[model samples]
Target: MSRRAEHDVRDLVERARAGEARAVARLISLVEDASPLLREVMAALAPHTGNAQVVGITGSPGVGKSTSTNALVTQLRRAGKRVGVLAVDPSSPFSGGALLGDRVRMQDHALDAGVYIRSMASRGHLGGLAWSTPQALRVLDAAGCDVILVETVGVGQSEVEIAGLADTTMVLLAPGMGDGIQAAKAGILEIGDLYVVNKADRDGADQVRRDLRSMLALATGRDGAWKPPIIKTVAQTGEGVDEVVDKLAEHHAWLASSGELERRRTRRARGEIEAIAVTALREKWGDVHGRSELDTLAAAVAAGDADPYGAADELLAAFTD
Candidate 1:
């Protein structure tokens, strides 16, 4: 990068660390766009990250994930905490852009200086998150957000990937959603740090809670493992959200006292590193002229002229060369 571009990135980082929302947004845009300055941006922001609590909210469609996130933000801000929200929406195939539905739902905080809300498109990426989510998260973390809420696309079963990225993974369910059985089928029971039964004003809410408790009882855990708490909430009315925030704090405390915070962060970092490395290798492989080595090897394997392992070895050898 030229000196002017380098200076601009430094200025952006400074503004972001000083709680400038536009600077934070620009940095995240760089991440989403895969800008050439991404490396410089990340290097500048690295020292300011790792402070925000990343809470992931995920569940099936119509489970009130967005409403619950908004309620949580209200409660957090009431306590004087600076909050950031990244709502990952399904990408529009025609436009390849976020539908911005989550942002619309969260307009109550639009004027709040203590809050920054961004909508990211999943862009056909699976696992309920955009591929660039972790890097976007670093931008928010470096921007002095006390808490970051990552509300994922309501992709049901595949949404469990949020557990790997969040410091606390909250799985939201509602009455009449078949959530009790669906939770088990989706494997969310294994990943949730907090289970919230939203829309509790409706009938069958207690039964859903009872069924969840019974199911959780059957799952085995190591001694002293933090038991996931199931909280009931009517997120639309902001009822029971305070208790949810309290449980989040307790979970955060346990994570610190048990040294699990460091372990989880380390694992998160390892995954980020692996993802970056794999993406780089794929880009390198795609750089070959006309027919790449991978394509040549794939053709040979398909023709039964070479075994898969041998072809893979040849590809790796070509890379090393």
Candidate 2:
């Protein structure tokens, strides 16, 4: 939160590769802040970031996300890559504690020096992903992880936002899941840089794959690009896990050759900036206008003195100064 503290965090971050869990924890906290100090720390760490292959995985609840993540971690570890996972879960609206403890599902990675798993709760954020996810990923990226897997909380816009944040977005859908198809309607179908039909051992696996392939076949991308590959995975048995990872690497290679990596990176950076800016604006406005101001605005609306849109416009006017 302060200048000296951020510097200390940088030092600790460097040591995190040496198995300094304390340093890793500290770096995570520092980046989670909205202070200028945080921005500076992130900037200083920027040169060291972007080395990790950021893979975002999202899908329906019954899609076996935890199982898939575990299998993916195993495959990555076999390749001798240091891996970090940010498991995003939703917090209770009342208690503000995560309802699903990610650690419970991911205990195998606990003592793995090559594997780092951190669970984050949404804390009632509407976006499905936690507010601090970007900086959190950056921290892991700078910590010398070769591959970072971000698992989004299975929800609507949050999952889409998670896809936007990844270098390769893998949507995990189960077989015969009509609900999964419905979830795809929220632009998840389009945002996927890659797709995974997990739980493929189940009935109707081929049908789901056919549906996805057909859907992808019908769509024309920005440049009439090749259809993103759909990999079937039975994570519970480690079936087709390596194929999924291979497809991810394939996408990255394609990104490098097609000159799309730079453009995608630029777009993702802008999205992160915008998300931070909106977050800052909300925090600042709340601080500037306190409860009294909000109450006044509410009363004005009730009295028909100020319309809701005009009241929001009033706040935007304040942000200008």
Candidate 3:
């Protein structure tokens, strides 16, 4: 990296550590853009990471995810915790930028110095999260956030991806949103650490909670499994949100006692490392996509002169050798 670029990163890191929001924002922007300086940035931030409690909130659109996130921020802040929110929005087809609807919904904390909120575009990456989320999360962690909430785009089954990244995953549902069946179909039953029925003041709220409990009971849980708690909330009024925070605290204690906290962090780190390595390999492979050796191997496979497995081996050999 150029000397000037290195100095920029150092300045950003220092400012972010001092709780400067704009510097923190710029560091995350570099991560979102996958800048060439990302390696240096991560190295600088590594020592300060692993402190924030990551909470992932996901649900189908209109299930009040943003409202719940906003409420959670309020609750956590009242407890004197610094909070960070990453609201993943679907990318615009033409601009590849976040639609910014999530940001609009979360304006309640817009002026709070203790809270940092960012909207990230999914950029067409599946699994409801932006490919850049974990990296962006590192920025927040290093910026001294006590709690980081990741609100996903809530795009069906792929939304379960959050379970792998967060320390605790909260799945939100509503009374009239077909939430019970939708939860089952989206595989959320397996991923949720806490099941929240938002808009609980509405009709059929009890039915939604009952359905969730029924489904969870029938689901075969592993030995010593952590049974997800069901919480009801009218996020618009912040009703029942304190209970949710209590449940989160209880879950965090349980995770630490059961040694699951360390295990989960280890697994998350493994996935992040593997993803980075795979991306590097893809970049290398992209340069050789139309190489003569690859074309010849493709022709051989097409002609039945060699099987797909054999062609794949040959292609890999070319890349290695």
lDDT, candidate 1, 1-321, per-residue tens? 899999999999999999998898898778766777988988988898888999988887898988899899999999898999988654343454555554576889989989999877655332224247888899999999989998875453246566788999998888898756676887777788889999999998999899989988888753258999999999999999999999988898888889888888898888777777777777677555555888888889999999999987887787888
Tell me the tens digit of each residue's lDDT in model 3 across 84-158: 998765434346455565457678888999999987765533222424678889999999999899887544425
* lDDT comparing candidate 2 with the true structure: 0.74
Rank the models by lDDT, top first.
1, 3, 2
| Whole-model lDDT per candidate | 0.82, 0.74, 0.82
Which lDDT tens digits does candidate 2 get at residues 51-159? 7888998877788888899999999888898999988654344554655564576787777878878777655443224346777788788778888899865443377
Index of the highest-lDDT prediction: 1
Runs of candidate 1 with Cα error greater than 4 angstroms are 90-95, 101-103, 122-131, 289-291, 302-307
Look at candidate 3 and tell me the lDDT of residue 10. 91
- Give the higher-TM-score candidate: 1 or 2: 1
Query: How high is the lDDT of residue 287 in model 2?
Result: 58
Count the clashes in each prediction.
0, 0, 0
Candidates 2 and 3, the one with greater lDDT = 3
Candidate 3 lDDT trough over 10 residues, lowest sum: 122-131
TM-score for each of the candidates: 0.92, 0.87, 0.90
